[model samples]
Target: MTEPLWKPSTQRIAGARLSAFAQAMQARHSELEGSDYFALHNWSLAHPEAFWQGVWDFTGVQASSPPKAVLEHADQLPGASWFPGARLNFAENLLRYRDQRKALICLLENGRRRTYSYAELYREVAQLAAALRRMGVGPGDRVAGFMPNIAETVIAMLATTSLGALWSSCSPDFGISGVLDRFGQITAKVLFAADGYFYNGKTCDSLERVAGIVKAIDSLEHVIVVPVVNERPAIEGFAGKHYAEVLEATVTDIDFAQLPFDHPLYIMYSSGTTGVPKCIVHSAGGTLLQHLKEHQLMLDLGRQDVFFYFSTCGWMMWNWLVSGLASGATLLLYDGSPFAGQGRVLLDAIDEENITIFGTSAKFISALEKSGQRPRESHDLSSLKTILSTGSPLAHESFEYVYRDIKQDVCLSSISGGTDIISCFVAGSVTLPVYAGEIQAPGLGMAVDIWDEEGRSLRGDKGELVCTQPFPSCPLGFWNDPENKRFHEAYFARFDNVWAHGDYAEITDHGGFIIHGRSDAVLNPGGVRIGTAEIYRQVEQIEAVLDSVVIGQQWQDDLRVILFVVLREGLKLDEALQQRIRKTIRENTTARHVPEKIIQVTDIPRTISGKIVELAVRKIVHGESVKNTDALANPEALDLFRNLPELRS
Candidate 1:
């Protein structure tokens, strides 16, 4: 393994931001001590009550009563609810600080850009909320959207949540079946969608699919089309209103409906690896406190900083990214392919927006490196103070590439946490130094520890990443999982009470962490265990490859590496290319890195949210049945892996 490029620096927090947190507390009439980073982090883990109570104050989290006490039931893992008696509103906290500060910046793929200030956003959200109320939408009713990352999407989410309604969303790229598979389960009375979405120099229309979905879902009685990508579609058989029709004449005074703390704030669905996607319900107060801790303490996003996380409307990262609004920073939205015009479009956006905090997936960084695209060479990225990476375990070489090609003196935060919690277990810390191949620390109040296969906790060793103590962010429970069977089966079944996040990780002796890969995706070749990322790190760094997926195919009661490479457009996986891949792997990793056969494909299968589905592909190669394949972007890609002659027993 290569040494880390950047470690923690001496940069300290400023008073103005800290003062904002303090003011938020005072306005809510809550009591919290003035504690520093490390001190408060340890304190929170030790005293869970005091920790969450502090967040309730720190973020000015409004509640009707004092919880009836915070956390009545802490012993029950899945049933444990925070601030059960308190009444709060998720959107209220987000819209608390209303001023002339730039709230959101939308950069469309069609070269159209629009900026909305906090005042403007609040007005739109209020007008839309009133329209929904008039449409018979109330608390507990679900509102769904097929949208891109833009001001209209945020406004819709905020408006829906403002009415104490459950909000769920997916990107426009999701097909009719894909949308139906997810939205089918949730009872969304109102469907919000765009007339079209622009991506890769093309304007794709969603109206027909929106109409199709309206016919499919019995609960959907209304549709609202936002004119973002193209002109609004003509109203036909569907009884709905365009966004302009609802909010053109805006009302300014937005009254937030306060609901119980445990009220469902969002209805985010699972990727449905096992079966149909289950709706994961997040609470109002819980989601607010958790996101605040992540943004302020972990990421340290401030008003001076323009925060941007490259994400679609579908992913949980989009929800996480949108919370930057509560932090008073300009939330930069890029609603299209990162490589739409150029591979460096996002990097160029950072320069244009003067974004202090920039975020993207690890796959994007690797792709940039593979394409030999240098952003630093072409653009001035000095305003980029920090770079955030997630969605997959960042390869160490990708780590080196960030410092060498992206920025040197910036914090490269590789965060790990997922849909299960809606917050990070192991994430970045403002006070800590940046390490090239590792995440700096476990998030504050998150009692994260590494555990071995035996369920025994281990330090300075790689094992299943587990969180021992109960966290505020753990999903209340899966929606429609009446007996909590799926919820328990998903998380608690692994190590009883501990949260087995399904990632293989090691806490460094120096207090950093190195995530190997998804624990379930670990490859055991000839009894020697190796992370899939280990192979990808070496294989992707080569000049000849575009992207590759390494899976362990079961053969003769042993595991063999079977690699599928999608070469750079016209490039083919020739003998010389295969040899170069092998040489690169052997140099960077072990003999296990080299695959037995390198298969070529036109495209790779990914989830609607853009994550490579290796296990599904493995099942396909083994001739196993794939259920709910609608979740895959390229479901036909799985067919290429089946019945290969080289894999004959």
Candidate 2:
């Protein structure tokens, strides 16, 4: 059995919001008396309606009308309707706080910082919402943003949703085609973009990309340009108003439109590594309630906490992080490379701002460890209490690094979910123990389970991660998927009414989950199923290795594992290092997990969100056409794997 990396003390557990909520629930329900974490989780799944209602009441959700019924058609997967009689605006809940306390702290890479009080933020949102209403934006209309991670982006989203418009956005770093692929599908009426932005100490102009995108997306009526880098860039060709001019003439009061519970609040996109991106539409009530539950109960976020997640506007974490405002926590937004300032930028921000809950990716942690930067030695992170990691599976070694090198007393949680639901199915709980390389527990009211090939639920074996019951955060459906054929094929095609979440996972004996990798990219060698993350966990332990990707290649009428590595600068893939790589993988994993072909590459192709695209590379190596090259951040890297002499053998 693996020892826990960190465990909450009796005082900490008693102080957690989860413990308080559980105690309240126990007082209301006799069956919940003396329920532990696992028992409470099981009860929540069994009585989802009661549990979700409790979440609403405990969070004090601000809705215009209370729900007549908790859930309708509870047995149906995609058709389950939650809070049928409720009416609410997503922006209303987020803007509930109007005090003078700090709400948002904006930081740029070039030593620029700004702060917004809750009252100031609400006034700004009201001004923008009024401006949007004057432009004829209304309910069900789509509005898009091609901007950086800044205060204005959040303001724009809030204003749009306040007018009952569906909001969608992509980071300014996306190319013209990538932007078109997403916003083009939904036909946004208004498009907001920055003139330019700074990244990695360079000012990257967005004017040219914006020009190309505006021309491609036909439904765009108004193009609002924000002067991020330049005070006023050349907007000669485009026909629209400047963001400043629009806001300057806006009124102070906003008329927030009250919509149905299932009104479309956001349109999130798939990674689109394989093909065109799917616009997954999420509901207003569902998004608000789920975020409230995760924020207040699961994460134990509150007013005094300073919350920060390293993400671009395009990533879903940005959406997740912005919801912190609803919990009355101060949001810290940063727009630049995390590696800026030689990786000390974010660490310095933590000390300066007294960040309480720090959220970032697993890759960032590994990079920090490899950089030999021990934050605890130089920074005062005493204010930090919880560290959240996602984007990819956090390795066990990274867990050790967080406790040993970062902060030992803090809770390190490796959460896993996707843009598909816009929230996590399994996340960390403050009342639970933190184990190495394992998510603390399945989220309350989420029926997360691991299943075998025959659809039998398994406890301690690796299998598909499935959600048997319907949850509020499941997307309303995909855009342009009128018959829901695409949505059905995407999630429920694998099993009957069960959401096969495409994750190779195992429910540990401790009631935690270990997500191996995406099931589509799972490696099968000699009829033995293997996860790519299993190999990556071992291969990344070598000091000489910088990054790696593993895949199963068809060879000799049987599948064989192949490994590709991006070695550290000035290090070559010689026999000694190759032997070390193979030995490390063999000793940690099984012999079959060792790669038959150990190749070195200068780069690994990843998606724009920093996720390694193993499926796209697999298609490239097999001489198949990758359907969407625009989906990749570095598409040219695919050529490195093409026509390789080593693959011929």
Candidate 3:
């Protein structure tokens, strides 16, 4: 048997929050007294009411009214209700700590830094909440933010949710149309934006786009601007108010609205790469409870830990990062490009700020490896403990690179979930050992399994990732999805009453889950199913191939796999490199997984949150229109793949 990459020592296991949680639960409910994680996980699924109630109590969730019952209609996926009769305020729970501990540390790409203590953060939110209250923003009102991932953005969101309002935000880099397509659907009453933001040593102005968004959305009543690029941005054309001016009322306290457990706290949007984005509404209690469980139990977060996830306001990880405040952990926020400072900017922050838990996308980690930036040899990383990665499958080589070059003792956890749940279905557990390329465990109480097309559970094989039972953090529903027709069709259409998460996945012998790729983007060639990640894992091992994207194209009578390569600077994809690519894939994977044609391109199109858009690229390859180019970070890259002369033969 192969050995794990790393394992927790006896002291580490004994000190883990999971161990402490298990001990406390066992004292109250004797059925959960085992030290085995899978045993505890099974008990959680079987007695979900007791498990969730234990989590709520263990985390000391600050609720206005205790839950009358833990769950209602527990068998229904869409109809199940959690903590139905409880009343709580999301912001109030997050802001429960008022001491002088550092709550937020803001780092910008342009060498700007700001820090906010817990007391200061609470005061800021109180003032902002008071100002929002005067504007008549109340329960069920929608508030929008077109800002960067700065302290102000978090403050604004807390203030909005404090008044029982729903908050939605997009990064400042989003185009005007993308902003309108999202905010237009919800008819937001207030908008907050930054004047401009810095990216890769370039200043990108956002006020012009904000003005355009204001004119397009007639429901907007107010626009507030924060100065980043300029001290006093010219807001002449638009009647926008400065962020500081709006908070001059000097209010020092907040009246947090104690709303229903299922009241809307946030309105997240889908990638919108295929069509208009779906506004996914998430409940306050569900989001808070699920985040507390993931943060405290899964990540082993504590008050002394400095937690950081490199995410923008547009991505769901930003929401996940902010929830660390509830656990009393300091949050580190970074804006602008992850590639700034020769890709050492984030690495430098780890040493400078003494970050304990660092989170980022799998693409960032791969890019660091490709750039030959070895932090183990370059920086002091004694304070760092865990690294969280998502947004795509973490290639197998990237896993090796981290233990080899990044840090030997750190836990590298590649988690997977989406905006659909606003949390992870399969995530990391501190109690588990680190494997080569696997998510450590299924989220407790998730009832996660891999099933074939017939809905029968499979072992050691690739299949659809499904959750037979519902979990908290399941979205309330899609906005304007009356009768839930579209919502049901989106998640439950494939299986009767089961949540069909659209991911091509496999269960490993270690009892961990490996996400191959998006199920919808699985390549079918010659009647054989091949996941793109399986090919990517092998191709990325070759140093010359900087990045690649694969798609199955229609041929004479069947589908053929086509590959596109993005070579390093001044390097060309000659015949030798093509043979090496095919040799690597054919030897590691099956011959059918090899691409029929290998073409070179300058760039690959990805979403604004940095996920490669395979479906959109496939549509472009087949001479079809990509409905929403605004959702892409580089829309121009799609043109490089169109009408390729090589594909004609």
Candidate 4:
């Protein structure tokens, strides 16, 4: 029973909704098991050409010229070109339906709300496209947005694509340096941003950061300011215009620029821990077809659903969540702190908006669980059908917490993928049964496998997570990296042609999967494999600590787990606190999982994007150089780690 494959329970998802034309091909192969999802998955992988071609045809994706085949280059994973010679615009596929159906639910930090219908959204995007065109925006040019997750941000992205301009963005919360490290690289010609944004009870202004970014990036030609809270700032040396004024003299029929299938639809960057940020360019056609498969078939997202992902414009979740509109679902966009004023802000939004698909990070979920938050018991969350968790590995305890404390019947999907692909390697499928702590399967088209240190395949055992071939979402290449050296070094260098995602995971007997932690983040105590998330699952359950990070310190030729905790407000980390942390972990996990030393710290270093920097902290504690402190939000925090009395032997 404990094999590397499991069958979905009764009432599985129907086979891909193939067109009559494609069905004839299936008919030619009568031996194929079309009804079984796994059978279909294996068949697609064996014939990658026919699988993607079917996806393009079924989605009705508009293209200027259909390609002769699905892939032009297959043997070379890094050089694969999907739908070669095809020309399509990403915004056109997203804006297909122009009826009065509600396209978006615009939310504010406070009590204000605004909704846009499909027709209204189209009109606004057209005006913005016209506005950008007047500002000298054209094909292959960069347009950046420093804005919140609201109507204008989505409009700006759509509008940029409409004009065949590349769209890139950062959330308003990004500090000047963080935003500059990313946006400064692409050399944006036009910038669209909000003056200020509200979160919790306080208003946060972006004017200063915007000014600094504009000053640093010499290519910025114009700034279009959307006043969300405060009056717009008057910055010198830049041509400025109001968003409303830009839309004033524009018509609603701006044409969608026809570009090749591989035209850059969006530009996203990697966290620059090692060096300069790598700008990942995605395609218009690939993004459209892939999102369609994820939304319509996997997620079953429909117009009846009102979706919301608690994310900022900077995160890829924002990119994924906004694509819900392409499924004709009303996406609920909230601009504020997710956990504000008692951690009930998102719950209130869910109740008020009746959000059907509510997504958040695993960190947020674990925090809520630790806080003893029971929104299902207190608030009305009946509208939510699925709860999605990602960013980090969602622990087994977190999975159990959702079913036991949050909602018993809701589908708890713990998905994992990253900025590199701009999509998921493993995600949810409503047609499949929910299991505790496991992602149901490798996303249908993904050829995901588990490999050990020797590069040999290992199933039903913890190993490295890898993908075998060129998936559509793979970044074309790193920007300014002419020889494609950086892109190859980042993913393919580990194992030639195979994408080493650096995640410690196992493929379960039932074809389900479990993520332990980042292979890089694993703690080796006495040379035993220990997932950092395992300690986190147990440590956060202690009442005194708000958060903690476990790192392995190399001492006397073996690794030891040293825990640093941030105590809850007004709490002291004394002997009693250490006892509680150790006891909790030992009782819940194993003896090796418990920390050897428990220390208190003011804060843990994280990227501006909210990823914990375990490697950074480990470097500091071991008296090694933290190669790039510039990537950290609080670089000065490392000073406390150095010369610690406890570190000296």
lDDT: which candidate is best? Answer: 3
Structural similarity to truth (TM-score) of each candidate: 0.93, 0.99, 0.99, 0.93
Q: Cα RMSD (Å) between model 4 and the true structure?
A: 3.1
Task: Evaluate model 1: give its lDDT.
Answer: 0.81
Candidate with the larger lDDT of 2 and 3:
3
What 10-residue stretch in candidate 3 is worst by lDDT? 30-39
Candidate 1 local lDDT, 207-279, one digit each (tens): 8888888889999888898886556677665776888888736577667888888788888877875478888
lDDT against the true structure, per candidate, is 0.81, 0.90, 0.92, 0.80
Tens-digit lDDT track for model 2 on 300-348? 9999999999998888999999999999999999999898988899999
RMSD of each candidate relative to the true structure: 3.2, 1.0, 0.8, 3.1
Ranking by lDDT: 3, 2, 1, 4
TM-score of 1: 0.93
What are the clashing pairs of model 3? none
Model 3 lDDT tens row, 418-440: 99999999999878899998888
Off by over 4 Å in 3: none
Model 2, residue 408: C-alpha shift (Å): 0.5
Candidate 1 regions with alpha-carbon error over 4 angstroms: 1-4, 7-40, 248-250, 569-576
